[model samples]
Target: MRAMAYESYGGSDVLKEMRLPLPKVAPGEVLVKVECAGVNPVDWKIMAGGLDALMDVVHPVVPGWDVAGTVVRLGIDVPEFAEGDEVMAYARKDYVHGGTFAEYVSVPVRALARKPASLGWEQAAGLPLAGLTAYQLLTRLDTGPTDTVLVHGAAGGVGSLGVQIARSLGARVIGTASPHNHERLRGMGCEPVEYGDGLTERVRALAPDGVSVVADFVGGVLDVTLAVLRDGGRHASIADHSVLGSGGQWMWVRPSAADLTELARLADTGALTVPVLRTFPLHELPEAFELSRSGGAAGKIVVRP
Candidate 1:
């Protein structure tokens, strides 16, 4: 199988296409024939060694976590799925070695969820990791109908999904983004607040009493989040750990079949949409990395094998 792998921690320059053997499925896992792989900011961050201290890395690493594919073979004792099942997952392992940026990937049954029939290969590929991050963050903060929620980095992969999820929960959402992306946010039922000077005032202009819940997807906004959060309100960050000391939770997404199943249900009902901004062939992963690093995309990037 031809796949992308990086032998060392570096930038896109290190990624290379190679002919590798199909991964053997372990018990409780399934081998998936990759249809599409989602490119995330974390993909490149991990490639750059940004997560060196937090997670162990193995050389010749395949860098991707979000995958949409078909099960080709089932490992021993894996009764949840069989060959030919269409599935998707946030397939991160305890260590970085094999991954979804390949022709085939071995995924754990615990992390598997049936792909939404309503979503295409690329869109389904985009959902797992980013969608789970947004879903977990909102639910952890206890978002509900009576609340007015604020989403930082509203137009990116996670924030875009965050706004839709909040809306589905009946909460009014205010999202921070550039003026150019405001129209997209509005389409998702989010009130767009430009993120720069006067950002707090802009959000306050809409919420007045300050938002009841704050979900931060982008880092470096701790001060801004605090300013517009109502006293005693809930807040959390996926990017910033400082929130832990400030009466807020610092979150990391966990892969759960149950959570991904709920998100799949939302997509099937037309309550959620994963807008795919671009697609690249599997061998062109380095180019995909460059696009994700540019920080200009307002939607998810995908790769088809």
Candidate 2:
């Protein structure tokens, strides 16, 4: 099988296209023929050895966590799916060897779920990791009819979905982004605030009473969000929250099949949308990684094998 791997941790230049033996299905796992793979910030973060304390890696690491594909073979213990079943999942916990940046990837049966029939492979590929992060963060908050929640990075992969999820839960949504994404954020039912100097003041002018819940996708604004939250309110972040002075929970999202299924249903019903900034072939993974790290993408970058 053809795969993209990086032998050392560094920048995108370390990634290379190479041939490797096809992975065999393990007990309780299924081998998938990947159709599309999603690129995320964690992929590059692990490439830079940012999370070395939390996980270990080996040579020729595959970086993809989000995948959309078809099941080609099932392990002996897996009875829920058979060959030819189309699915999307978060695969591989080990950044070194667990990955979907190849023609085929082996994943536990529980991590895989049926893809939404209405979505294409590219859209389905973009949902697993980012969508789950947004869902889990919102679930940790005290969202109610009178509560207002602020979402930073409102136009990016996770924040875009966070805005919609908060609104669907009956909370007043406040989202932050640059001028270019203001209209889109408004369409998602959020009051858009520009993310810069006086961000708290801008949010105050709109909400006046302050937000009850804040979900920060951009770690740089933790202080600003803390200032904008009302006393006793909660703040959650997918980024580092050690510097955040709030008492609310600092969150890290792990893959969950139940969460993915709910997100899939939301996308199928037009309540969610996974925007794709670009698509690339498997061999061009380095380029895809570079684009994801460039900080200007309007949506997730997807790769197809």
Best by TM-score: 1
The residue-by-residue lDDT of candidate 2 on 118-151, one tens digit each, is 7899999999998888889998776667789999
TM-score of each: 0.98, 0.96
Residue pairs with clashing backbones, model 1: none
RMSD of 1: 0.9
Best by lDDT: 1
Which stretches of candidate 1 lie above 4 Å from their native place? none
Q: Which lDDT tens digits does candidate 1 get at residues 110-151?
A: 999999999999999999999999999999888999999999
